[model samples]
Target: MCEKCETGVEILTRNGEGRRNFLRGGAAVAAAPLAAAGFSGSRAAAQPSDALAQSEVQAWAARDTDGTFAPYTITRREARPKDVVIDIMYSSICHSDIHTYKGDWGMPNFPLVPGHEMVGRVVGVGSEVTKFREGDIAGVGTMVDSCGECVNCLADREQNCLNGTTFTYDSPDQVSGGVTYGGYSKRIVVTEDFVLRIPPGVDLAGFAPLLCAGITTFSPINHWDLKPGQRYGVIGMGGLGHLAVKLGAAKGAEVVVFTTSQDKLEDARSFGASEAYLWSDEEGLRSQMASFDLMLSTVPVAYPMQQFLNMLKLDKTLVNVGALFPVEGAHGMMMGFGRQSLAGSMTGGIAETQRVIDFAAHHGVAATYEMITPDQIGEACERVVNRQARYRYVIDMTAA
Candidate 1:
């Protein structure tokens, strides 16, 4: 049985022998679609009889702080009663992955497998799993698990769990007693609640980035309740910035792009910006001071925060989603003069993550990406750091 939670997310439930019976009956119903889709169960299935048994899967991992990836094998814990095992098809490289791999964020757990944005087909489910079935197109994002008893989790804010949330990779795993591995592998086993369903008729590869970049931008927009015809300013036209322009415009806001790259001005407009200007254009920037209803900065590097904050109208907000470092060059006067607010956001909670994915599908928004094989991850990381990638890079894990 299923019922809607306060966030309007359907919560699936079953108990005791009823759950086992449902799994036995649902297997055929699930397998029929997989067979029709040419899914061969030879390699994907993980129906281990013992709960303590583990499955060895092939993956690429960064052995050290150098961030170079090489072939490795990792073990996935057997499916628990509420688990779903996925055969990964594509995994997108997130900037956070690069940061973690390079130790830019801190000393990561060595031999880390860094990935979060992934889309795959369900291959197996635990005996009590009810929300997903074999062959469902599903995704896993930044988080895999959170302490469900926390007030934040109960409120559908698992990303902000007062108890530590288990990240997709390199976080202390509460369930397995080791660090969590991520989707840079051939397969992964995740709890059904953390797995997301991909909407039909969407580009699977293109949709992968929606798990991270899409939600990162949408959460802030959703939080601020950006209204139609409001002037929305986006800083930086990289991965997050490009998506912000697309999403902001889709929300009926008058989108504007403020980028450091002259080349991105036209590209920004193409992504749905009504106006595009170089951030270095002092006169051009000053002309629009206090004119924006909301502004979002997606630039990872430190820049003049006061400049972007100056663009907001009184009582308006400027949200930061990209920078992980200290924000400099802003003072109390910038905020006090207009009652303006500067805030930061991480990826959304599970329900909000699903909403963003569905929202993008309904509105035809997706990341523009370049495809590469797992072997190219090293080079791709370099490209990402150099800002050479057009927007995003998605790995074809099947090539491994």
Candidate 2:
């Protein structure tokens, strides 16, 4: 039986009575009874504040492999008994979004809506949903759902679910019968188990990137057991690297930044990095040899793995949070010499993601970002590929 059957049936019966009474009383019928049962204002909208209908959600989509974004209208799924409908307020452009949009990662579903860093307000809930209510702030990150019965999922590591995991966009949808449309839309319907509650006091726009970049960096830190006073080196000063600096510093680590561009030094330091060094500096690289306890490489392109391996102290580890491409011919002896290790990680599970959000808020940490509108998606994506964005770019849907 559905968990909320008793309450749900009661509500549905009252709704039936409401319709009958409305038919009898004509235009004179009061909406008080329907409102009390959770369905009143706006047809099918869970909350009175929602301005969108499930079928009228506007989105920016790439209709072909050309990767040009344009306005599109897509229908959202009807809210299920255990689902929540969100009216999207903001969506951040992640590097992965650009890659997927351009087909660099692979051929994505045409007419793709690419965005995972989503922030919005709950506008509707399923009858069985008790976690969220209308008018509450909410956020959605990379993966939307997984096989709940998988061993990894039971361990709270749903990202590594033994069964296939479902991503926010370009993923097959079992319910809606098409590839899932993502946060680059007016609204989305997600299961209650996958939606995260947004805490008060976080700048909603600034907090959006945390749903992706923040969790990407934070997961590795916690997985590797980063501790206060440990020397941590963050390679690359892009989206993931910038967050690593702030989160590592917040953990009381002596954070250093390794970058290819000399100009990013100030930007790195401003993000709470203790020092920034050009990775190209031979003398500087050698001087820091075997000094770091943990180093996170966020550079999306492959570089000299041996050089980074040389920076770790005995029994230390270097974790990669960026760059899905494989490194070519990295010398294993470098790590073997010092008993060091190299590893890779994706975003954290749902619980860990929530913990990262709360932890970042507690530290007053947020990604530095520039805001753009849906019309600017093409240019915004170009800037990210060109490494021209200051830190991150967020699509302000409120301005749409």
- Candidate that would win on lDDT: 1
User: TM-score of the candidate numbered 2?
Assistant: 0.87
Model 1 — which ten-residue stretch has the worst lDDT?
Answer: 1-10
Stretches off by above 4 angstroms in model 2 are 1-53
Pick out the ten consecutive residues of candidate 2 with the lowest summed lDDT: 4-13
Instruction: Tell me the number of clashing residue pairs for each predicted model.
Output: 0, 0
In model 2, residue pairs whose N, Cα or C atoms come closer than 3 Å (at least 3 residues apart or on different chains), thus clashing, are none
Candidate 1 off by > 4 Å: 1-53
Clashing pairs in 1: none
Kindly provide the TM-score of model 1 when superposed on the true structure, using C-alpha atoms.
Answer: 0.89
What lDDT score belongs to each candidate, Candidate 1 first? Answer: 0.81, 0.78
Q: Whose TM-score is greatest here? A: 1
State every prediction's TM-score relative to the real structure. 0.89, 0.87
lDDT per residue for candidate 1 within 1-400, as digits (tens), equals 1122212322222232322233234542453354325534324444445322478889999988777899889999878888988889889998899889878878988788989999887777888777677767788999999888878877678899898999999999888888999989988889877887777667888889999999999888888877778899998888888899998887778999988788888898899999999877889999889999889989877776987898899999999899888988877976899898999999988777876776787778999899999989888988988888789999988677
